[model samples]
Target: MFMRRSHDFTFTGWHMAGVVCLFFGTIISVNVYMAYQAVHSWSGLVVENTYVASQQFNGKVEEAKHLAASGLSGTLTVGAGMIRYRMVDAADRPVDADELTVRFKRPVGDHQDFELLLSPVGSGVHEARREVLPGHWIVEVTGLKSGERILHHSKRIAVTGPAS
Candidate 1:
C-alpha cells in the first residue's frame, strides 16, 4: 500500500501578471538606456543648413580635385605643445604660403574644436604652439596665398600620450 501527499502550489493570474511585467520591464529599461546614450554621445548635426551644404558639395569636390592635381602636399606633426607643417611640391621643393591655419576637431563633439594660426618658420615650415588634448581628432590644415587657397589637407589621428 502507498500514501499520496497533496501540495498547495498553483499557477494563478497574479503569477502570470508578474512574468509579463518583468519581461516588458526589461525591454523598456534597455530601450530607455540606449536612447539616452545615443542622445548624449554625438550631436546629430554636421552642418547648420543641409540644403545649403548639398548645393555646395559639387563645388567643394571640384576644389579638392584641383588642389590634389596641383601636386602640392604638406606634412603635419602634432605633439609636445607644438604643431609643425612643412609644405612641398611635386618636385619635392619647399613651398611657401602667405597664411596657414590648423583646425583640431573632436570626432564626436564640437566642444573641443579649435583653430590655430601657424607662423612661418623659414624653409616652407610653419609652426604653432598649443597643447592639444590626447584623443582621437580630425585635423584640418589650410594654406592660402594672396587670399586664395593653396593647400587643403585633412587627416584623422590618435594621440595616446599627454599633451605636455
Candidate 2:
C-alpha cells in the first residue's frame, strides 16, 4: 500500500480573491502608467487658433507665390556645428541681405529653441557656428533688407553627431 502525504492547503475564496486582485491590479497599474505617459508627452494645442490660421492660409500661399515671383530663393545647410545660408536672385546671382535671423526649433517642442542673428560671412553667405545637439530641427531663415523681410524659408533637417 502506498500512502500520499496530504497537506491542509486548499483553494479557498481568499486565495481566489488574491489571485483576481493581483490580475486586475497589474492591468490597472499598466493602464495608469500608459495614460500618464500619453497625457504628459502631448500638448493639447498645436496652434493658438486653427480657425484664424486657416483663414490666413490663402494669404500665406499668395505671399509665397509673390516671393517666388521675385526670384528670391534661399538655401540652408546645417552641418559641422555650423549653419550656412545662401540667397540668390532671379538672375541666379547671389543676393546679399542686410541682416539674417535664423530660428532653430524642435518640431514638437518649443523648449529646445534658439535664435541666431547672423551677419554675412562672405558674398551671399550667412553663417553661424553653434554646437547643437543631434536631433530633428526646424530652421526658419528670415532674410531682411532695410528691416523688411525679403526672404522667408523654413527648412526641416536632421542633425547628426558627426560633421557631414
Candidate 3:
C-alpha cells in the first residue's frame, strides 16, 4: 500500500507540470498572434485610406484636362502681398466661380501641406491672403461643385524676400 500511494503521488506531480506548461504555451501563442495582427492592420488602413482619397480626385483631374484641351490656360503667382491665380476655361472664356480652393505645399514634405480657399473677385481672377514663408512651393487649384471637387490645377512658385 505504501508503494502504491507513492506511485500515485508521482503521477499527479507530472500531470500538474504538464498542465502548467500547456497554459503558458497557449498564452505565448495568443500574444504572438496579436502582435502579428497589429502590424498588418495598420498597413491595411493606410493603403485603404490612400485609395479612397485618390478616387475622390479622379473627376477633378478629368475636368481640368477637358478645360485645358479647349485652349484654356491658367497662371499662379505667389509674392509678398498676396497669392494670385487666374483661370481661363474652355471656349476662350474666363472662369470666375465661388468654389475655388488653393493649396500651398509646406516645406516639411509633399504629404504635409496647407490649403487655402480663395474668393473670386472678377472674371478669371481669384485672391487670397497668405502669409507664406520664403521658400519654393507648389500651388494647386481645385474647383468645387456643391462641395465636391470637379477640377484641379497645379503650378510651382517661389517666394523670396528682399536682398539683405
Candidate 4:
C-alpha cells in the first residue's frame, strides 16, 4: 500500500506541472499575437493616409483643368532652378497667369514624382524656381482656364543638357 501511494503521488505531481506549463505557454502565445496585430493596424493606417492625400491632390488638379481651360496652351521649358511654360488662348491671344503647376511622372521604380508651381512673368509665360532631373519625364500644367493641358503638350521631353 505504501509503494502504491507513493507512485500515485508522483504521477499527480507530474500532471500538475504539465498543466501549469501549458497554461503559461498559451498565455504567452496570445500576448505575442496581440502585439503583432497592433503593429499591423498602425502600419495600415499610415498607408491609408498617404493614399488619401495623393488622391486629394489629384482631384484638385482635375478640377483646375475645367477652371483654366482658356489659359492652357504653351511650351514648357525645364532648366536649372527654373521651369517655364507658355499657353495661348483660342483667339490667338496669349494670357499670362501666375501659379502654373508642373507635375512630372515619377521616376521608374520610384513611387513619388516631382511637382513644381511656377509663376507667370510675361504674356503666356509661367516660371518656377526648381531644378528638374534630366531624364524621361512627363509634364502636366494646371491652373489653366481652358480645360486643356499645356505642360505635357507633347508626350515626353528628353533633357540632354539644360532645358532650353
Candidate 5:
C-alpha cells in the first residue's frame, strides 16, 4: 500500500504585507515617474497672470481678427547666418513698416526665446544677421508702424540646419 501526501498553502501576514507593498509600490513608482516627466518636459508658465490674460483674451482676439482682415502676410526665411522676412498685402504688393521684429520662442519653454529687430533692405524685405539654432521653434513676427502694432503673425517650424 502506497501512502499519498496532501499539499496545502496558507496566506500569511508576510504574504499580505508583500501584496500591499507591491500595490502601493507600483502606485508610488508611477507617480514619481510622472512627476519627473512633467517637471522636465514643460516650463509650466503660459502667462504671468492667468486672470489678467483671461481678461484681455477677448480684446486680443478682436485685434487678431482685425489684423487678419487686413490681409498682411509675411514670409520668414532662416539662413546659416541670416534671417530674412518679406511682408506683403492682400493684393500681393510689398508692405512697409516702421519697425519689424521677429521673436523666436520654443514651444514648451521660454529659456531659448529671443528677438531680432530686422533692418529693411527695401521693397518690404527685412534681414538680420544672426545664427539660429537648429530645433523646433515658434516664430512670432510683429510689425509696428508709428509705435503701434500693425501685423502679428505666428508660425511653427522645424529647423533641420541653419543653411537655409
Candidate 6:
C-alpha cells in the first residue's frame, strides 16, 4: 500500500496563460468577425449630401405636417408577392394619384433592395406585383402626381420562411 503512488496535477503559469488566451481570443475573434460583416454589408452613406439634406429638412417636415393636417393617410398591405396600397384624404374618401413609387428594402442585408413603379387601379387604390423575398422588409410608398412626390407612407413587414 505504501508503494501505491499518484501523480498530482499541479496548476502552473502556462495553464493560466492558456486559459486567459482562450477566454480573450474567442471574444476578440467574434468581435472582429461581426465588425467585418457589418462593414461589408453596410452602405457607406445614408445620405448623399448631408448639408443639402439638413438644409431642406425643415421644408420636408413642414410638408409632412401640412399633409397630415389635411388628414391624408394611407394603408399598405402585403401578401403573397403582392402589395395593396390605398390612400385616403381628410373626408375618409379614397385619394387618387397618377402613379406611385414603391421602395422595398431589407433591414438586415443590402442585397435585396429594389424599387417598383406601381400603377393606379382605381381612385385611392394601387396594385403592384413585387417579388417580396421572405424576410424583414421596409416598405416605402410615395404617391406621385404629375411626377411629384405627394404622399409618403412607410411600413415594416416581415415575410417569414425561407426565400421563395
Best by TM-score: 1
What Cα-based lDDT does every candidate model obtain? 0.93, 0.85, 0.71, 0.65, 0.92, 0.82
Candidate 3 displacement at residue 80 in angstroms: 2.9
Candidate 6 lDDT over 1-164, as tens digits, reads 36744987889999999999999999999999999998987776677899999999999999888766767788887777677788998788998888887898877666779998777889788888865778788988888778776788878988876543
Instruction: List TM-scores for all candidates, in order.
Output: 0.91, 0.70, 0.53, 0.47, 0.90, 0.78
Error of 1 at 41 (Å): 1.8
Best by lDDT: 1
Q: What TM-score, to 2 decimals, does candidate 1 have?
A: 0.91
Lowest summed lDDT across 10 adjacent residues in model 4 is found at: 39-48
Name model 3 segments beyond 4 Å from true. Answer: 1-67, 90-92, 107-112, 145-150, 162-164
Query: Candidate 6: lDDT of 43?
Result: 74
Candidate 3 lands at a TM-score of 0.53
Residue-by-residue lDDT tens digits, candidate 3, 35-154: 988765443333447777788788756766775665645777677657777877666578766588888874335443688888888888888877777776777788765765545777
For each predicted model, how many residue pairs clash, with residues at least 3 apart or on different chains?
0, 0, 0, 12, 0, 0
Q: Candidate 6: where are CA atoms >4 Å away?
A: 1-12, 161-164
lDDT tens digits by residue: candidate 5, 1-164: 97766866889999999999999999999999999999998999989999999999999999999999999999999877889999999999998889999999989877888998999999999999988888999999999999988899999988885534
Superposition TM-score, candidate 2 onto the true structure: 0.70
- In the range 1-164, model 4's lDDT, one tens digit per residue, is 44545444345788989999999999999999999887654433334477788879877677557545734457777777677877767676777654467787733433446777777787777787876666677666665436543333434776666643
By TM-score, is 4 or 6 better?
A: 6
Clash pairs for candidate 3 = none
Task: Give the candidate order by descending TM-score.
Answer: 1, 5, 6, 2, 3, 4
lDDT, model 1, position 114:
97
What local lDDT does model 3 show for residue 116?
A: 85
Q: Which residue pairs clash in candidate 1?
A: none
